[model samples]
Target chain A: MKPVIEIESISKKFLIPASSQGYQTLRESLTSLDFLRKKREFWALRDISFSMEQGETMGVIGNNGAGKTTLLKILSRITKPTSGKGRINARVASLLEVGTGFHPELTGRENIYLNGVILGLKKREIDRHFDEIVEFAGVKEFLNTPIKHYSTGMWARLAFSVAAHLDPEILLVDEVLSVGDAEFQKKSLVKMNDLSKNGRTVIFVSHNLAAVRQLCSRCMLISQGEITSIGNVNDVITEYTSFRDGDSPGTTDLTLISERKGSGIVRLTRIELRNSDEQVKGTFLMRDDLHIHLWLEAPVKVRNVKIVVDILNSFGETITSMFDSDSGFGLIEVEGSEHISITINDIRFYPGKYNISVSVISQILNHKYESFDEIENAITFDVENQLVNRNLTRRTGLLFLTPDWQIHKD
Target chain B: MAGYEIKPSGWLTFDFRELWHFRELFLFMTWRDIKVKYKQTFLGLAWVVLQPLALMAIFTVIWLKVMKPAELDIPYPLFAYSGLVFWGLFSSGISGAGESMISNANIIKKIYFPRIIIPASAALTALFDFVVTLFLLVLLILYYQIDVSLPRFAGLFSLSIMITMAASFGIGLIVSAATIRYRDFRYVMPFFLQAFFFVSPVVYPLALLSSDSLRIVLSLNPLAGAVTLARAAITGNPANWQAIFPGTLMTVFLLVAGLTLFRRNESSYSDLL
Candidate 1:
């Protein structure tokens, strides 16, 4: 298939505040607009290049400020690039955010025509598909009502329906799929999947890795305005997870997270997660052998040093907790500073991004010495379905396991 | 469905062919603006008539009844209403185009279009209001039994004058561009229009200011010529060509300059906004 969209080394720069304090006054704004101070140059995207075939769906994955949206804006022609150039052979439709193309005062019926025109659809084509569009949006009854009165869900559903129905050859969708309810999200997913299958070039950007994995045949991992990796969806995701997990400040960079008395006696020196190869790894699959290692220094000999590993999700919900001394429950002693290694085999977990918190504690909190050195979002892991038996089906919950099933005809 | 090719610097070069493709959209948006304006309002199109008529009444009292400036041999209401129609056209056109970018900020930031069409369409919308008020002026002319002289054809000159002043309203396009970057343009526009209203021949006829010294200065304001031409058309009188000609020239000059500024600034709009 011929490439429908070819992006050639495009970059976008923005002038953001060097100090992001509030601009509360017009005088302050005008002074800043004077341009001798306050503003700093930000390269939102830098020399990004990619090409997509007519029918390929490419997922763009990145953290916040990773230029995913900037690339999309440049491709969709909503904003001009600061440098370089890009070309697309077919029509482009973009839903960068929910309700981007909607006019609040206009009725849904009027908006359909307006949005359709915006998306490069002819009036007669919208007229022909008017019923289908309303039905798809599930706002058939309220089509005549001004959109301001519609619920956000109703607005999103109708806006997305108009955008999705345009049948544009190239579609750039940001993370706005998570706008409506779960059922609507599922329906939208199905629609996007269908669009991908139909061979229209699609560029999907979202924080939901599962959706990217499901719909995108290829993906790119961007970080700090550059493409760190690009290839198959799984490979790019693996690289991204590994990169993020590695760059997270470990126990070594504890000054930012250090909580200590003015005495300055004991401090966290380092932390390590050694797999079977003695190499640091935060990534783990379901039922994988895992190990935790730590090296610290103390002025005096410490006893009853217990290590607690708490896994937290992105929202700070603790998913699981494990105490190092719970199983072996031994009083270990360390002089000055010494490297300590702890191993746990058969780590059972789900497929998702997770955070690890490490705390050094004494079994008896009766005048405990060293406290929790803050390590936040320490690691993330993905669990894949690895089944050995043909009869075992892949399960859908946090932990994928074989469930006994019985089928009956009713 | 194909995307329009954008030149790096040329924003006002009208792609007539491309605009023609979206002609339906232009027409629909124009109609939608009109419908939404009159919808649910008790007066409906009467609001259009009321605006100029009310302004005419107030100006008549203030300029003629209160000040008793100059007789001008015509009824004050007719004179003020004539100027009010063109004044409404010019003022509303600029305000409409100035607010055009902000009001449609959602659509402007989302999709790509000939951004010029926005202000242009707003000017056209004010044209509708102007037409409705013009009908009222014709009724006034019949009631007064004004003579329709051969020079009345000079009123067609006012149509050209109306377009030129409307082009002058295209100055809002420049303001729209400025607003995208520094939103200070939004706060400054209403005050600018209000202050400009006093200088233009809206409240009083330009013919009333018959001083040889003040005539040139008043003629410099483009709306002065437009209002005078409009007054001549409705009241069946000779238009003051000396004032009207210079004002028309200024209108064309302001319009071309505004278009150039808007075109140069349009590309950076999305980035700044």
Candidate 2:
């Protein structure tokens, strides 16, 4: 079979303004339209080249901001590259996100046809698959109801349903199969697997490595806008897990982190992750003793102060929240400079990247949770598999658990 | 399903075939806009009729009573309604196209279709509203006992659509594309359309202008040509094709310029959005 997709040195450049009102207003652009001419240039994608054969499901594995989405966007023809070209010997359909063009005011049925057409399916094809989409989404009863009234899960299911039913020569999917409920996610995965089984070319980009492994015959690893490795799925994933030492930052200076907002009763100076021997580290194995160190300076004595640390997965979805008190576990009062190290005994996160976010809150003025300081995605680390048969090929899902299993004959 | 190629950004890459493939999406987007524009309102599609009908009624009374016409053989309401029909098309098309990019930013960022589809469909939705009002214009013509040749009326009607759509699409294309890169174009559109209304012969006659230079200057506005064409078609009045020629020429220029600008900026929409 011929290669369905062939790329040659594709790259994308973006002009980030040095400073402005964020969006280019008419007044500013009228006065200085050329202000971005001498601005800092960012290469979101850099000279990327790859090729894929027909019926091959290629998995794209990369760290956050590794140009995975940029690659997909280039392939999908949403954005043009600064240089280079790609030749595709198949009709391409890309689902960068579910419900990419769904109208909230329209009913579910209308959205299916609308989104289906937007995804490059013909109106007759949508009419042919109309019943199947309704059945798959399990929203047949609410098909006539506007999508805005549907629950988030229902919305997601219907969106996925329309895209899952698409029959294209090649499909470029990005991080969509990983979303939705577990049961629905499994169904979507099975649909994707079927698509490849029918000899359709698929390029899947997902943070959920397990889904990628299940659906992709080959895997590609991209780091810092370049392909570091591409070949067998197992080999690439192993390389990905091993190449994380320098990628995750161990020490994060929080004072300089601008992604924070608060009323300022306290100031967070720094945050650090430490291993069992009190050595600063970013990569940790499952069931390891993880200590979160927080350095803070308080101006006044704060009463009923509670600190919450959120552990988020690679997609920035909160996996777990650890705190001094979830509900009245005794809020502590603090004044002046203080250092607190919260030790998580036998942390059980599965193999993946994770980020830490901290929130300092106090119940000030009649039971209102007033925030003193907060920062998100400030510190990040990688979790390596730490068990027998420790293959990183399958990301296995978050929160590694050792539930006792017993078999009984009925 | 055959093959395709992704090339570097060109000076102009207006793919007509790709736009044709997205025809269903165009229809749906236009229908979607029409459905959503009046969704959850007390009078949904009725507003399509009520708006123009009310405007024509108010303008007819004011024109005859307050600002009396210098020379008019035809009924005032018929004359007023004919101009309102196409004027609605121009105003809605410009505003619709101007805001189409911003309103569909989410879709533009996620999916890949010709970016022109959004503004073009928005213009079509405006045309849909105008079509509804055309029924009223027909009734006004018959009510006023105007003589309209069936053969000539059809050609004029189609010409009026082409000019109005071309003018709106031409200017709207630029407004919509410019709005994406520089949001100032968003504010400029409403002000431009408001000013354009005074220049067009919407509620008044071009003949009333005593100065030949002023009449020619006003006729250069594309809507003036469309309105004049539409009025002549419905009432069987003689049309000055010369006065309408420059505006028609400007319409073609704007459309070409608009398409060039839109196609140049189309690939960067997802990045900027």
Candidate 3:
């Protein structure tokens, strides 16, 4: 089969200034010779090469800032690669974001035509699919009303409906399916499956591994702007997950992980898992006491801080979350290094691997919460069943809950 | 499936065929601009004519009462109004087109349509406004009882509007491209237009300038020639080809230079934006 999309040694470089200026005016740069000295080159993508045959659904899995969006942009022709080239041999449609070109003041009906044209459809083609789009979005009643008045969900649905109806020979999607409700996400996945089955090529970039595993025939793993592996979906995803988990489970240096976002006032310096005896351990047994130790730092005296920890199953589904506020501990003040511990009496996580994500937020003067730090899947650990000589099969679902039943003689 | 290569090309090359293929997008964008411009406004499309009419009234007072320049063959209101119709086209067209890219950065960053379509749609939207105001111009002409010369009026009117369009589009291309990198253009643009207004002879006639060299230099401004030719068309004055030729050349030069600069930076726009 002929490749529908071919990328040859493509790389993208961006210029970064050493100074922390958000944006400099031309006048300031022209007047100061120091500006020229501060400029530096930052490579966003390095030597990325790949090709996809017709009807292949290729998934791109990576951590944040792994150059996935940059690659998609290059293929979609939104920006050119600084070096190398890409050849696209089909009508291409890219959904970098849904409702990208929507005009707020335009009626839903008018926007359908406008967005359709933007997606490379002719007027008559839009007319033919107009009813289908309106029906799919379930906005037929409000078609004549301006989009500014529509609820956000309705707007996303309309935008997704239009994009889903696009009949391009090649589609480049970037995280747009995560929007709208779960029913719509399911519908979109089904629609994408249909498109692939119909022999249209697709390049899907997403962080949702489950969706990628279900939809993609092949997958590529990118790490720090380079392709680490490319082949079967399961193989690539395994490589990606293993790399993310590191060689030692439940032992991660919070400072070393670059995929974190928040204000710089507070930081999560370190994390540790401890047992009831105050000994640190990576592996725990089912029904054992699970203790999480967090080391935090604040540059200045900060108050009203709340920390949250979420336990996720192997498939990246959240099993449960613990919030500091639930214990009626409204505030914690930190000026420097401080250690906090969270102890769960019963683990109940049934003999499987699970990951933990931590987040820190603070309440401001107006009583609105501002995020201070958030790290997803920061550490992974395994749970084992230690009970012996009992015909006990490892439980099937998320947790092995202990329930007591009392029976009365009838 | 139409195949295309994504290699670096020389700065002067442009894909006019690709732009032509995306003409439907241009039309739709233009339609969107026109629709959104008047959506919530009370007067709606009337604002298109009202803006120039309001400007004409202020300029008439300033030019007639304050400057008190030398008389021409036509009424002062007619002279100022005629000049304003084209001036409005040039100024508003360039402003609209120049800001098109920055305003549509969301679309540009996501999709793969010809980038030129954005500015072109803005120019066309301004053209629609110009057409709307032309009716008011016709009413003013009839009200003032200005004699119309059919053969000369038809040819010169179209040429004048075309000249304005070309000049606006040319400048607009450069401005829109620059705006992506240097957002200071957002603040600089209004001031630049205001300064350009005085130099374009929108209120006073070009003949009011005493020195021959001064008039010739002023005529080099594309709007100067367009406004002069349009005034002549309405007032039945003989066309000044000598004065108009220099401006037409400048218009062509601006258009070529603007397009070359625009095409050179087209691919990088998304990056900067």
Candidate 4:
């Protein structure tokens, strides 16, 4: 079977300026235009390709500003791509935004006909399905009233019903379905599922991972304007989640964006905190081992240096302190560059925001303890209380690790 | 519904058959515009008649009573009102259509339909008002005891002239396309319309100009000859078939050129808007 939408080597490029702020001015605006031209280049979608067959439901998951909407707009024929080509062999319908084709002074009944024509439906076809469309919208009572008189929810309902009932062969849904209430959202999802079950192709774009997992049989992960992974829904979502968490603020490329400070003699070049499975994380359970991997660079030789990990709460209060020298942990001499690993097992912190403060000290001769460099609130994370059993129980205190439970019923 | 024949040639071509297929949509859009225009209007359709009537009264008083340069023994009100009807159709239709895309930018961005329907329907809405004023012209002409050549065919002849003037103003297509990106045209169009209203012989007759140079310059404006001929049609004067023929040809040329340019820019309107 041939793919219903054959998108081959489809790359969309945009001429976006480095400084694209829409400013209204004279001299500064001219200067900014000069700056824009100097730092602008073609932002290519980059050697990418994808195709989908009929009845296939594919979900596109990506970060913000990752060209997901641009790809969808090109497929919808709302905008032409700067390069590459694609073909769609289906009656495509799109609901990128609500209240799109509505006239303010026109009634709901009038707008439905107007939108029907906009969607390429003939007058006879609209008349045939008119009643069903109106009934689905739930605005039958306000059918003849001007749309401006209707509330926002009523407008959204009518807009959704018109696009939904049109029943195009392919549906391109953007993140606009979240406008309605939960019940309507459920109805719309059911409508989409029904469309897919009836051998219609659906391309859904959304940020909600759970919805994508529940609805899409195949999903693609987009990162930095490139398709990173595709295929099995679970594997793709897992890869996406890892990609998102691994790029969290303090974990990714800390050398250029580290919150720590140091003299030029030695600096915190890199840091990675991972779980037991070797997966980098920014969020963790309260009792998990907070294994920290640090890469430090020293310009000159240093000996007998101590490291400290300070845990602070959301209000900047230092809750606990774990010092390497205090625990009598042995330290080796470093000449230029060295790696250090610190594992604090069974962390017992309350449910709130916390940061790690790393410090280095020296035990040198003729001097007691000399401070090398100290940093505050470098890594931040959130903790959630463990909800083990729901027996209407309220457990107190931060430490609930390795709970000992016994029950006897005779 | 999905399959369509892609044009073999890369250049765009007019699809008159597709337009005919969507005739119902055109009619519906025109009806919607007409309804919303006078929905809560206090005077309703009477405002249409009152607009040209008031303009004729002012022109009659100012040009006849105040200026009184040269008269060919014609009723001042009839001459001025006739010119007002044709001029109103041209100015109001074109200007209304010129602002249609920007004013209705919401509808333009979302849907994929023949974008020409927007400006075309706006032009038609103004045409409806022009028709109401034509009814007043009929009453005024008969009341004034003006003689006509075959009064039965007078209305049909006037409609042909009115439509010609409307087509002349079909330059709105070009204006609408340009206004999407520049937006400077929106500010300039009203003053341009005002200047055109005077230069088109709406307030004065063609005979008022004694110089050959001025008459030749005025004839170059499509509406100047058309309006003069339409006035001659109602007043039983010898219709200047010479001037009317060339004027009609120019109006059609403008209409065709305007629509062609508009179609070229229609597909990219969303990006520019």
Arranged by lDDT, best first: 3, 2, 4, 1
Q: Residue A322 lDDT in model 3?
A: 83
Chain A only TM-scores, each candidate in turn: 0.64, 0.73, 0.87, 0.62
Tens digit per residue, CA lDDT, model 3, B156-267: 9999999999999999998988887778988999999999998888888787788998888988999998988888888777888898999999999999988888888988
Separate DockQ for every predicted complex: 0.21, 0.68, 0.64, 0.15
The candidate with the higher DockQ, 1 or 2, is 2
Best by DockQ: 2
Candidate 2 CAPRI level: medium
lDDT of 2 by residue, B1-273 (tens): 477788788776666786777888899899889888889999878888888789889988888789866776577777777777788898899889989999898888777788888999999999999888888877877777878899999999889889999999888888888888888777777788778777778888888899999998988888888878877787677877987888899999999999888887888888887
Q: In model 4, how large is the Cα lDDT of residue B175?
A: 83
lDDT score, residue A128, model 1? 90
**Which segments of model 2 are wrong by more than 4 Å?**
A20-22, A243-271, A275-289, A294-341, A345-410
lDDT of 3 at A140: 91
Which wins on DockQ, candidate 1 or candidate 3?
Answer: 3
**What are the per-residue Cα lDDT tens digits for candidate 4 across A1-410?**
87778776666555534554322223444555754455455443554578899999999876545667767766776655655677788888776766676788888898888777666567788898899888988899999998999887888888877777768888888876568887777778888889999999999987656677778879987765678888988888666543224357436444553223344355666667777666788777767777787777778887777777887654334668887877778466656888888887767776655666677767545746666566554566666666455222123544455668889797
The per-residue C-alpha lDDT of model 3 at residue A363 equals: 62
lDDT of each: 0.70, 0.83, 0.84, 0.71
Q: Identify the runs in model 4 with alpha carbons over 4 angstroms from their true place.
A: A16-48, A223-225, A244-281, A287-410, B4-10, B72-74, B149-169, B245-249
Listed for every candidate in order, the interface RMSD values in angstroms are: 3.4, 1.3, 1.5, 4.6
Q: List the residue pairs that clash in candidate 3.
A: none
